[model samples]
Target: MRIRRVVLLMAVGAALAGCGADGEPIQPTMSANVGVGTSGTYGGVGVGLRRGGLGVYLGL
Candidate 1:
């Protein structure tokens, strides 16, 4: 009984400690484009942006 109480208290304390302030949710932006012309070939480009204003891109 005593051991159970101590274990329960520790579990509650751990749960409270884990409840930290939430951080700003990430808002991302993404874009892609593809085009085909008279030729039998295609091209595409993609861009991505993250919360910190960082950007990544790919093209083919």
Candidate 2:
């Protein structure tokens, strides 16, 4: 009985090990935006990740 309990607890802990803050896993993403002026056009591109209710971006 004690061995069963220990095995059950180990299984539960292994299952919970995969759990984490609710949100998508960190992943690479890209975005772009553009605008036009009377005489010219402008645009920007960025790459970053969106994870755990936060976003990071790098652009040029």
Candidate 3:
């Protein structure tokens, strides 16, 4: 009886695992980026917000 219970539990766990999201996980909602040139004359900063496949970014 105990062995049958164990086998049943294992099968359930496997089925649940297979039902997980099919692709890469969603990214975070907020992010920042900064860049500078070697000559010290070029630099910029950016802020962004993302949701699913949509996002917005602002840079200077």
Candidates in order have lDDT scores of 0.45, 0.58, 0.46
lDDT of 2 at 49: 54
Q: Write the per-residue lDDT of candidate 3 for residues 1-59, one digit (tens) a residue.
A: 65565456545544544543485433323233555678655433344444467654544
- Say which prediction, candidate 2 or candidate 3, comes out ahead on lDDT: 2
Task: List where candidate 1 sits over 4 angstroms from the true fold.
Answer: 21-60
Off by over 4 Å in 3: 21-60
lDDT of 1 by residue, 4-51 (tens): 654565454444434432654333333546667788665443333334
Q: What TM-score would every model get versus the actual structure?
A: 0.34, 0.44, 0.36
* Winner by TM-score between candidate 3 and candidate 1: 3
Worst 10 residues of 2 by lDDT: 12-21
Judging by TM-score, tell me the better candidate of 1 and 2. Answer: 2
Candidate ordering by lDDT (highest first): 2, 3, 1
Model 2 lDDT tens row, 1-60: 655654565454444433433545555565678999998998765555555676665564
Better of 2 and 3 by TM-score: 2
Positional deviation of residue 17's Cα in model 3 after best superposition, in angstroms = 0.2
Question: What C-alpha lDDT, on a 0 to 100 scale, does residue 29 get in candidate 1?
Answer: 36
Clashing pairs in 1: none
